[model samples]
Target: MGEVDPAFVQELEHRPKQGIIEAEGLPIIDLSILSSSDATPDHSQALEGLVKQVGNACRDWGFFQVINHRVSMEKREKIFNASGKFFAQPLEEKNKIRRDEKRVLGYYDAEHTKNVRDCVKKLT
Candidate 1:
């Protein structure tokens, strides 16, 4: 909750900061379809559009992203704020929440997933 420690900010300066080498815009799945009575059993009005986007993303790009899933920006900010506090803890303290390979759910690092590593690569 206090000001972020200066040394911690300095430490992040050493992490990777390269630009993305390859990139593609992903389709955004809107959650509004879930509540629409007009939607099909699979919750689709743009069902074919969603299917095409998802199919292309998986078959060609290997992954996709979602958007407009109904979380407000205010709620999203709170989540990020809580995340900052959790990540700010020292490794000894943070490791308590580290997830195991089998029970992976908690604060797992970037070393385990190529998908995340690739995204970081693309982002940086």
Candidate 2:
């Protein structure tokens, strides 16, 4: 089939659902129990507390981050730099190796299509 008009896609009708109800605020978890000179003599107590907090957050907000993970600072920096570089590229360059076609490699639009593939090819 030929290219589909984006406007048409956007206008396609769909079933309606009940509106979401806004909630008050997130529940607070006490993390102070995780730190001390002689607290429990092992990380088990701290870990248990964290697990409970994570479970609550997951149920209430659907997401959260762990602060004490052992990933190196250097690796985190590299990830941030790489993500920024990818987003900063010209639109044409990004579409050249679209993600859908390459599957495991190449850049593509957020929806995964190869449309404007020009800028990056010219750079290299």
Q: What is the lDDT of residue 28 in candidate 1?
A: 54
Tens digit per residue, CA lDDT, model 2, 1-124 = 9985553342223311224223535445555544545545466767687788889787655555455455688998898778778778998877776777437677745442133222322211
TM-score of each: 0.53, 0.39
Which ten-residue region of model 2 has the weakest summed lDDT?
115-124
**Among all candidates shown, the one with the greatest lDDT:** 1
Question: How close to the true structure is residue 3 of candidate 1, measured as C-alpha lDDT?
Answer: 85
**Best model number under TM-score:** 1
Query: All candidates' lDDT scores?
Result: 0.61, 0.57
Candidate 1 residue lDDT tens string, 1-124:
8985443342344443344213444545555554557746555546666767778767655666766677887997898779778877998888887889776788666562332332232232
